[model samples]
Target: MADTIDEKTGTGRTEQIRDTSSSDRDFRLEEIDLNSNRDAKIKNPLAGIPHDALMRNVEDFAREREMTDLTDLLKKGAQIAQRPSEFETIEGLTDREREVLRDEVLHRWRQPKALYFTVILCSIGAAVQGWDQTGSNGANLSFPQEFGIPDTEFLDAAKTIPNPNFTHNLWLVGLINGAPYLASALLGCWISDPLNNFFGRRGVIFFSGIFCLLSVIGSGLSQNWWELFITRILLGIGMGSKASTIPIYAAENVPASIRGGLVMCWQLWTAFGIFLGFSANLAVQDVGRITWRLQLGSAFIPAIPLVIGIYYCPESPRWYMKKGMYRKAYNSYIRLRNDPVLAARDLYYVHAQLIEESHIIGKSSYLVRFVELFTIPRVRRATLASFTVMLAQQMCGINIIAFYSSSVFVQAGSSPRTALLASWGFGLVNFVFAFPAVWTIDTFGRRALLLFTFPNMAWTLLACGLCFYIPEDSKAHLGMIALFIFLFAAFYSPGEGPVPFTYSAEVFPLSHREVGMSWAVATCLFWAFVLSLTWPRMVAAMTPTGAFGFYAGLNVTALVMIFFWVPETKQRTLEELDYIFAVPTAKHMRYQANVAFPYFVQKYIVRNKNAKLEPLYQMDKNLAEGQARSASISEKP
Candidate 1:
């Protein structure tokens, strides 16, 4: 094992790290070959340096960062990175350090309360996000007539009188319904980079929370449709920025072992917010004209905890390190991890990887980094994958239901009260089903869950659309519509619903995280804007069956795109993803078409006894090779 011990981790630090200094380096050093496959392995940056030299370098790192007090810990951590099994045997190691190291592995999920608290705070922010998106859903039924906006009666059985301005009014209602996403796409998401740069994750969330609170209050108080549309636009600033920052904040502080499941709280709680929004609609459904206002304004409740509680949560350790605040980063890491050794190990490993990234990606202005997202090979693949997930999210057609479910129910022939109640059922199923992903997302994994569920979502959504053709007079017609819609939500909750946000959050190098996420969120929200704006017209032109069928076809297209373009990221450290995205896209696509597809047919479809599937990516021990996404599903960690 290259004379290095790894009692818990698989194998020892590789000779590849040492060979970097040799004339005949196998992997090119000009840039990490962030090719298209997960099979490519990266040499550990900490692999080969001699103990004394490494200690000297560690000392230099500590001194330069004004963290000299941590020099000894840093040196030990480098030793752990270079040789983990020998961590128990490292020179001058205390019993407590050894015990803590063991605890880190055995109690992977037994995290510090502070860490879980931080995740909760981030989840609350997501709840605020979900509440914002859906508050207007129930309000959509009542608010149009109050503000003279066009109604959906022309498209469905529950038609209002044919007004002369029906076409213009329909477009106007769509415009208002879609304003938040338009504002988010055009303005709010793009600004997240600068905001995150200036305020850090916590501060950006606080800023967004205040905006969310104020905007919801403003929506409730608006006297006209235009005023309400403007308020929704203002709300998008909060929604977009919060969406960009919270998952990243949660990802940065958590351990990689459970990162997916924990980060998934964003989707889980957001579903809860949606459910609550629907419930609030029912609570005040009988309160007369002001009921719409209550539904629109009640979203401010979740934002209250978000703005007030952010200060109590620790800032991201990576953010502090990026800003050159090593001492503060260490403190934050300490609070976030259970033991000092664990914290030290993460801090130093992340520091080393960041240094490697600077050499690979090159540090520069935000614009330069933004440019590099496409210019750099590794970052570009990440950009492509991030874009795919975000775009597929809208393409899957989940938002059409989310943004307009009540109206959809009314069109399906339910009474207004029955429609609102049915929408609540949709919300409940969405929230309840998301719970499974909190476990499976880490086990079955992000890519697998998405792959498995997309087809189900497609068929179910198609079923919903087709059910629209059933005669409205039959009691079975309304029941079937509600059933298929809920089924669509069920399929959506565990896969597309959470994967996009979580996947986008972790795919980029820290240097480009803010801007990369902005691009991704913008892609998602922009398409969402398109869907919200065009659905009224599309449904008007295509009928519910045609509209739903079109998106179901889109869901299939999205599934194909995901299989070809999206890489699995389950169980990977944020820093470790550099290697995951390094393989060229051509290489990744070739593996899937030539190797993965063949293996799938042999193993799952053909049921061949001897067919074996080989992993495409190879990682050094320093990156925790065995704990990666390449591990077999039946294999224990």
Candidate 2:
């Protein structure tokens, strides 16, 4: 063991012993002197730079290292052979891999896992909104007893009977049901933008969950209608704020490839929450007066995951980038994109866009930012598109079905128990149908879905109105009404229900996204308030038939507006769509059906032989070429 251990040191030990004849020539720690003054003067050199700048440097170093590694690998064979092959020089990847990598760098491929967990966590905010809406539907069945309204009067009244509080009670029900949206339309519209600016997208959503929890508790524990109304208003503030913020938040964090599907998860999860609410309602239906309390309180359950889970989620990189927190944005962008190359590429684009936006809206106040949405030609057109989609969504009257499902089923000639069961079925169908939009929204195109589904919903709603006109109530009549209602869910869920929120989120640029979306959500809340506040009176005055007929006609108007104004936003990057809305609204609207729509049909379909679409395609080609020429000329100066 000694011989083996000493064998390697034998020659070195002899040389050291020979050289140690003079100890002054020996190595010593003292000989290697430290500059004490210099060290003392600079205790922590990193402290001289701002934290954000330091972080940006770190990110830049990491990105450079990645690039260096890629460059070295690509040049390795060429350097050794002194001759670079075309195939070998393609970014350290094979031809097929290079193509895929190029697509990823361009942000074209679907990447779900990287952002899925975070997006789903954010979607719980939407679920909270749905829970409040549908849970209240079940709660309305029983809350009247606690509030001094008779079980068999007003909403539950089998036959019209004279009651002292009939008109007052009906209005009170409308107020209670519509209070959240009223608060959302008023208070929420004002707060959502400022809160988003001050606290960021995630922070506002976090606060929304807190508001939901506390307000739900207040609502469930209310001793009187006034108390419940106030709490419901608070709850509305939370829901309304979420409506405006969550979609943009999710959209900014996700890749544009899966953006529509992920953002539409807002509605998808809301439907899930509604299903939970209806199930909760069914569970407690026999619990006497406490049934309503349990139903209302159940909204708090989803708020738990929302508040707790959101902390683990990263803030939007675009939000950080907008605030000039480059390091934070880079870090977040990296975390959100698993591919380092793709992350670096997307971060660069975000930086470029921020600079462009700053140039465009220099020193503009927040109010001016909103005004520019109406005054700037491109932004104004986009606003109109967003506004119409949101308005159309609400005008489709899905909320009427959600808020008054119990009453509608009761009016359709079902017993109270049977009506409650039917409400559960409606909630299930609503939840299940939303899954299709997850697949179709990114595939079939938003404009097509809206155009096709609106007519089906209108016809189904018309049939529902016709069903109520049957003089004698029969199983066939009830079944027909139920079928129409189901069909409405089937059509609306995949199209109008999810598309509006997704579309509105997409059209607005980063600078005005929050305020723009807030306006859109305000439109939704306004219509929600309108429908909720007036439905009882409308049903009382016009009968259910005329009420549904009004909604049917509204759907038709929505269909027309969508066809004329809304552009197809399938498979396009968020920034790439600027030109689509840049044209004058008057010109586009005048020629859309005659010139644009046919070209869309020809390009997306009829690829082999299509003479009917040729003229339309040529017209569109000329229009686009002319616009490009004018833009280039304008820029040349």
Clashes of each: 16, 0
Taking the tens digit of each residue's C-alpha lDDT, what string does model 1 give over 1-637? 0122232463443221122222222222323444333457755656656676677677777776677888788778778866765676688678888777666566667889999999999989988888888888898888888987648663462345546777777778778878889988888887888898777899999989999999999999999988998999999998888888898899899988789999989999999999988998888999999989999999999999889999999999998777666688899999998777777888888877776676566556778877887888889999999999999999999888888898888888888899889999999999999999988998888989999999999999889988887888898999999999999999999999889999999999898898999889989999999998888778777788899999999999999999999989997789878888887888788889999999999989999989998877766764554343224323446
For model 2, the local distance difference test gives 0.71
Query: Model 1: what TM-score?
Result: 0.92
Model 1 misplaced regions, further than 4 Å: 1-39, 150-163, 621-637
lDDT of 2 by residue, 304-387 (tens): 999898878889887765654545666686678754444555655444333333434443457887898887665777789988
- What are the candidates' C-alpha RMSDs? 6.6, 16.7
Q: Which 10-residue window in model 1 sums to the lowest lDDT? A: 15-24
- What lDDT is reached at residue 352 by model 1? 74
